[model samples]
Target chain A: MYWNADLECVPLEQRRELQLERLKSLVRRVYENVPHYQRVFREAGLRPDDILTLDDLAKLPFTTKDDLRRTYPFGLFATPLRNTVRVHASSGTTGKPTVVGYTRQDVDIWSEVMARTLTCAGVTQDDIIQIAYGYGLFTGGLGVHYGAEKLGATVIPVSVGNTKRQIMLMQDFGTTVLACTPSYALHLAEVLEESRVDRTRIRLRVGVFGAEPWTKQMGRELESKLNIVAIDIFGLSEIIGPGVASECLYNTGLHIFDDHFLPEVIDPVTGKQLPPGEEGELVITTLTKEAFPLIRYRTRDITKLYEEPCPCGRTHVRMSKILGRTDDMLIVRGVNVFPSQVESVLLEIGQTEPHYLLVVDRRGPLDQLEVWVEVSDKVFADEVRHLETLEKTIQRELESTLGIGVKVKLVEPKTIERSQGKAKRVVDKRDLYNRDK
Target chain B: MWVKQISVFLENKSGRLAAVTRLLADHGFNIRALSIADTSDFGILRLIVNDPAHANRVLKEAGFTVSETEVLAVEVPDRPGGLARVLDLLHQAGINIEYLYAFVSKAGENALVLMKVEDLQRAVDVLSAQGITIQGHDVVHQI
Candidate 1:
């Protein structure tokens, strides 16, 4: 077996000590094997022995996305290529792909973590889990697949697309657990409603969704539409896969596998770690990852961490859903704007879909914000004047919500490009320095 | 039987017109006649080009949103009364002229007046039966 399930039943204090011991040995192994970690450690003039306890982890040098970009492909892997069983990469839309490697042992650990996550979500051996995340290059599909199999549940590797067939399988095959991104799950619910399929007739009872940040309103909307309990599963390809953390039946916050992955919130600009309940960029350090052990890797995701014990009897650390990426912030006319803020406002409007594009450009000395919103056919008549009025309404709502005036452009339905993977929500065209020269 | 014209939306910004004209020059499309209708915000630049179809496609591919419409192209003698006779026929037919611009044909025997009429087919028939030639081309090559 990949994991000792008995560890879940063990005392929390004992698990921490065992994890610390394992982390120390893993740190020593990486120091000897990985050149990048060795140079980083040596540059800080720190030895592996200096990290005696988990608290001493702050002394280690932090890993940034720029570091990952610098070591593009397999430069960060601690193990040789022959030992790596699988390789997954993040969609490097801005640049090259950020690659991650997993050894056989690392894969086993990942499966165990995912299994624990699914079990906490109440998925059992009797359930048929449909994995709907896109497979290949992206880690969501295969990550959830292994976890469901590890839980002794029948795994249906129904990689994303063909929504009609997906729903048919759910109805015919008696699928109980659905794994997909939250946006796609909502899209499927919309599709189900359109097809007039009786939502209650489906056997789906629970859903595990992640890979993108979704609001609580979205969760409630999906729950009402599908009549299934929606849970969040959080992970990145840089860290293990989609099962590194997951929400329990409580649905409050996602429980991190603190024994394997140490979570820290740090000021993104200063690199200073923050206390619990303080929102900042999340930093993660691997405790037992053998192939690619990262120490204090800056995730750029903004969220708060809490260590309070959950009602589910797990003492793992809980992290709120990510608010937004620090890099995704847009400066419109000297006022900072986040796309998530726009999304929240759109959700409040209750008529627009989550699809929106932030078009930023400079008009003379002032920055212009044009929000291209896709309107459904039912809500909008096919007339230019009506669209203009609707646009004004959206603009007014956004101004009140964000405290910044913005122009809204109501686009036709299906105008925005549907992304098969990560969605590109922002397009900024203002470059004053380049323009002046 | 057919006449084509190009209408370009020009923003009130520096070098905007130069960019559009330069693109046409590079593509070897010659401007037969052009007119500009302007407001404070933007200008509608209408053109009677040597080749409208090719010009429209080229301008569109270069990221300019371009559309086409039919206009009456009347061949009037290079004299005053020849122009007055065709306008009289259109007036008698109750076809309103929104706006128009005239260009001297390269042959110089006749002048071509591009007319934006309320009814295109009726104007074409009215001018043709009155013994005035309607200069509509299927294809006009670059000069």
Candidate 2:
């Protein structure tokens, strides 16, 4: 089931050798070309020769989102602007976006890895892939686009939006594979149901969903509603884009193309490397990236890595689903509330839909967490007592798990806005209060 | 006799009551009697509609949390102490009333009292033996 059987199924010993060789070359490249890495190395009193073995990567300083931001556009490019063919920027809603450049060969590498991504998801040349990730500076659209085309699959460059039209095209074109964010996939499912489009008419069998952190409940919901195998693909604009890693049909974990991109987990506060299977911040070093070769770039995404062989027969190490962003964690009355935790609670209860919004507000000096979830029309039709009991059950479970009191509000279906991209889950109103003060 | 009453759960937010009433009105469901039990955070809206089944379906379809329960409708004199006399009979019969609401009839000098109790059959028998007129759905709807 592996796409690049030669590399994907490589033995662990050879994989380490390949990673070490690539790491040596990458360290030399970044130091010789990019001033940022050169300065970082000088500050740490380390040299590229110091990184002979993979364990010596600890000697290097960690690159962070702030570092990328400080470098700004094109400052971190290892190659001259003339050698770069394409550039993609991260969606930095808070501030300036992190920019990444790719040479022609780098673009080809992206396409190759993307081709591998498609193959791992069971997509073939016979499949028609409709890429719903946005085009332009966002790497998702073009990244998935070129990869599908590389795999010889028919590519529909229909970027995001126009929900009804998307469904119509799926029916008319008999699209076999769909590529978009998981939230957008769910949104498309909702639109499909609303349009009453016959599911049998469409030929979608596989969905490559990513771009935001989602829950298993969401995965099950998407699979049942859209009638497709929903697989997760993990990537970031800083490293390469959407082709860094993906989950196979086995649904074990996402196989990080370790040969191309080396993955590591580190404690967020201590900045010390944590053992595999322990939850920590993900730090990735690009072993094959040319134009933007990052050295131990801290991705800020929280996850764990497992080195065990996958059932899919891929020897590459697997990473767990991205639970939440380190910055996205909410401290409510001294209790840490990860949206994923709330999602898991809701999923376990099985009383409401998967959609929810966490509202954190400041009540006087104390913080209050309010969870707004969508219940089915049938549950809503129950007696007031029953509804009260449901609310209490949700509240009790949340309090027990999150270690803080949470007010559960059952809202009407579709009241929360559906995103065609990343689902917006948390709304912190305390910031506004602080601003006013 | 027992009459079916529809109760809806509503968050204590502005325009919710109006929205529910507008939805029921839009569906041509006539309300026979209504009462609201309120708290700081939420409200329970209880209604006696002309067609409880049809109203329940339409309200539920409109995405309102609604439920149905059996409550008794008794006719009392419109004058003062009319409800007191009925309560005195229930007290002597050891029947405890949960909640009750009254509606003044335009066709006569009689007020309709919708009563909810733990035991509907026992309340009906006690009221019937005491000669209290337990109004059926037909009589209540007409009023």
Candidate 3:
């Protein structure tokens, strides 16, 4: 279960020393090659030599997605294109995509880290991994693919889409490990139930889900639905891709691959570092990324960091599941309505599926929050009174939990749109009012 | 005698009831009697089909939440107060009728009524002691 135990279980003191050394070298590399970091360092009146210990990481200039956007294509690459082996770009739905390059060593490190990710979930060489993540530009598919291959597991490079066929191959190939987004895993579970193939025939035992913020409730839902141990993998294209951190079978939290990625939580507005267990925006500094090393990159993901060693014995720092993005927090009627909070309520109430969509609309002055919950077999009752009672209970639960009155709408099964990747949680129709204004 | 009644849960949408009937009809299962307990959002279609077990299995396999409940089917006297007489008997025995639906029979002169009661065994005892004919599966299946 322990992949590269020496590095993973390195003593705390030794690990910090290693991190300090790596951080210093990464700063020097970026300072020498990437002009953006050089200019930012000059602006901060700091030199690469100033990065002495790991604690000095906070003093380094922060890298934002805007910074990555400013340096579009190869501007941030420390190594020349000839020296880099692979390049991956994030989905630039908001604006131009942020690109990242990796040298051969970086890719090898990615594979090793990803191999640790697999091993965290109890995956081994005897396991057959079905990679359902999208392959090309999206690093999730290939990142896991290379890692699974490196782990000596039989890799079924079945990229996303064709859900029915995905289920068929999953059963036929006897897949022992499934890798995809949490939402996509739920979608696959739904399809598997609706399909003719027997679930007992399927050999999937562990799921490596990432690429979007999902709830612990969703993680439990995935476990029960797919009958697999769900492990959460955290990574971004700006860093290295799907191997930055992972949840072991212990599943207390994701253990950041301490040897490679240095994680810190900071107050979003103040940018001051928050102590362990304080929820804030997560900032990560790549310690060993060669082709694209980042100094204190703002990930925009909100979560607390736990430096305590995991019961699984990995010395890497652990992090809570990403609560909500600092930028993507949905505010309706002045209440922060995170889809994960709504998800926890739904799953805890039981009977309803872990699928729901939040619709925020402004009628005149007040915003209306309508939750569309998928009625599953358990939620459905032959008696109208029973179903009505369930609806009322959900409304009451949401109102009490969220501190905002919500209209609960019970929709038919399979009515809500499911994503093959990250799920669409909210539909902000209040944009109509904004548009007209 | 207890008769198996299958209730299917469905969303209150146009043609949903028709869809359930169509599924049953396609499967060659004849509905002996039926009743719709509806609200604005959903409806529970209670049915007395020719084959309760098969109907329940097929309906469930088709993604419908189906459950079977046992109810007593009684033979009512072919008179003006036929249904009323049966209700009066149950009421006199202090047994509460949960729900009652009419089941017409082509093979018999007396009308058949399916009634679910709170105390099922006691209701059967009270009806049988009053010399009323409690219809069984053999009789209900023929209908």
Candidate 4:
């Protein structure tokens, strides 16, 4: 069995040779095993032998989200269901959730990737890892859960919610490393301060957050609150889970596990591949996944790909933090708006709950957006006039941040629907077909 | 003396007024007089409509956050001094006007003024005793 090494740290010539060899084997496996790949290759009128190097990767058919959804359930799994040890799914906002499976070997490889990520972040056996992400079909909680266990760190699988208990566990257990979504981490920090808990006394040193696209401003806020180093972890359930790549302590781009997953940047509109340092959609192909292998799956996440060696000495390809999903982009009154843009503005206006909903609808020929924000009791006294003033302030801030006018409705705290699992932040009521009419 | 009064909660957005108008139209109701008491985010769209109960149900069914309120619709002369007389009466009675709007009556000689006051019953009693003709619920529906 050939084991993959961190070839990016090795000499440039050696890394290129290794990548070329892996690329050739990956193409052969897809052509020989996957029926979809075979049909695509036949339609393209190209033989598997034509793709013998990394340069030939362009010849392969690009997989997309539509393909994954059309397959549904498990039509794309390369191995039998019995061989699969784990399954994870994305929230089915548009349609049926995309299901992904992993065999025993695949799970081992996932843990190994996460272990490398944690090790790169300076986490060791002496660290106590607190996993705050939710468990179950969602991969974030358990992905970090097992990865910490594999690294011989004391794992606290305290899933999401119950911030009071999470804070208690952090203080009592002396959690040195935290893994969670960035929003929840900030919520925890808020709860900690409200409860008069000294943030430094908890002894948290490092945090790995993902599962939602967060900005650098948010990362800095989280770092300042918890007095810990915050790093971004990147992955998707279709490709793997939370441990596909992670940022080092340097807080640059996340390093990809190029040995098992091939990363590429492509123009979202034309599907043409872009060169390094250019912003585009991140595409990945599972090189060694046996259970639910994906070939050149187009992730709608927008980011840039970098091939330059990081200061941390990892030869793995690097990806910048994802800005937003192309599918989630909202066009309100002929202007584009991302939920993260709203989130950034909310963060700056301290003492506000992160829970918010974007209501999009068309009024006559013009599109309108209303942001329902949950008001914190400290800022407003729950009176109608006070809440209204807060709403105006939110509207002004959002207009300044997004450069588009939006009406802000101040809802009572917890009035917005809470997500038991993956949160649905956007509620678009615009009729796309009628808009043209 | 009573007038048909209807209250509706409206979030501040463009075309929201159109939505309210369409709902009332679909229910075969017509606005007699209307006033909007607003804060920044939302407004209470108070109205004296053709049918209060029917308008309220239609607004609710249309998913608009709405409520019903009893406002006073005082009849005044079509002249400019007519509104001033009613305002002077209310001010003397210590009644605070939250908001008010005028309606074009069919007779053209008399105008209907919809008034939302802090105290509904007290204002009605004060206006009725002052010889100001309070339009009945039937006259409101007839409009």
RMSD for all candidates, in order, please. 14.5, 17.0, 18.9, 13.3
* Isolated chain B TM-score per model: 0.89, 0.94, 0.95, 0.83
Per-residue accuracy of model 1 over A1-437 as CA lDDT, tens digit each: 22344665456788779778977887788889888889999999999999898788778889876787788877888999999999987643232557899999999988889998888788888999998887887788888888788889998898987989999999888899998877678778878888978666699999887776667776788888888898887887778877778888886688888788888999888888899888889898888898888888877778888877777777788888876676776645323466777887787777777889999875532457889887653454322334456667788988865555788865534557889987778887754211110
List TM-scores for all candidates, in order: 0.64, 0.60, 0.59, 0.64
Q: Which 10 residues in a row give candidate 1 chain B its minimum summed lDDT?
A: B134-143
Q: For residues B1-143, could you state the per-residue lDDT of candidate 3 as single tens digits?
A: 68999988777778878889999999999999999887676677899999999998998888777778888898888789977877888899899987888885643778888888889899888888988888888779768
Q: Model 1: per-residue lDDT, tens digit, B3-115?
A: 77777655556776898899999998788777876544345577777878899889867755455767777778887698888888999999998888886454357777888
Q: List the residue pairs that clash in candidate 2.
A: none
lDDT by residue for model 4 (A1-437), tens = 10124443666677667767777776777778667778888999978789777777877888876777677888777777889888887643232567889999989888887887787778888999999887887788888877788888999998877889998999899999988877678778777878988666699999888876666776788889888899888887778887788888776688888877888998989888999988888889887788888778887877888887887777778888875566766645323466767876787776578888999865532357889877543554312454566677878988866655798876545557888986778987743311110
Deviating ranges (above 4 Å) for candidate 2: A329-437, B1-143
Candidate 3 ranges with C-alpha deviation above 4 Å = A329-437, B1-143
Which is better, 1 or 4, measured by DockQ? 4
Instruction: Candidate 4: list runs displaced more than 4 Å.
Output: A1-8, A198-200, A329-437, B1-9, B12-143
Q: Give the range where candidate 1 chain A is weakest over 10 consecutive residues by summed lDDT.
A: A428-437
Q: Over the stretch B89-130, how does candidate 2's per-residue lDDT look in tens digits?
A: 888878888789876553266778989877889888887887
Error of 1 at A25 (Å): 1.8
TM-score, cand. 1: 0.64
What would the per-residue lDDT of candidate 4 be over residues B18-134, giving only the tens digit for each residue?
Answer: 878887887777776676766766666667777778777776666554555566677887887988988888899999986677776643568877776888788888878878788
lDDT of 1 at A392: 73
Best by DockQ: 3
1 versus 4: better lDDT goes to: 1
Candidate 3 CAPRI classification by DockQ: incorrect
**In order, what DockQ does each candidate have?**
0.05, 0.14, 0.22, 0.09
TM-score of predicted chain A against the true chain A, for each candidate: 0.75, 0.77, 0.76, 0.75
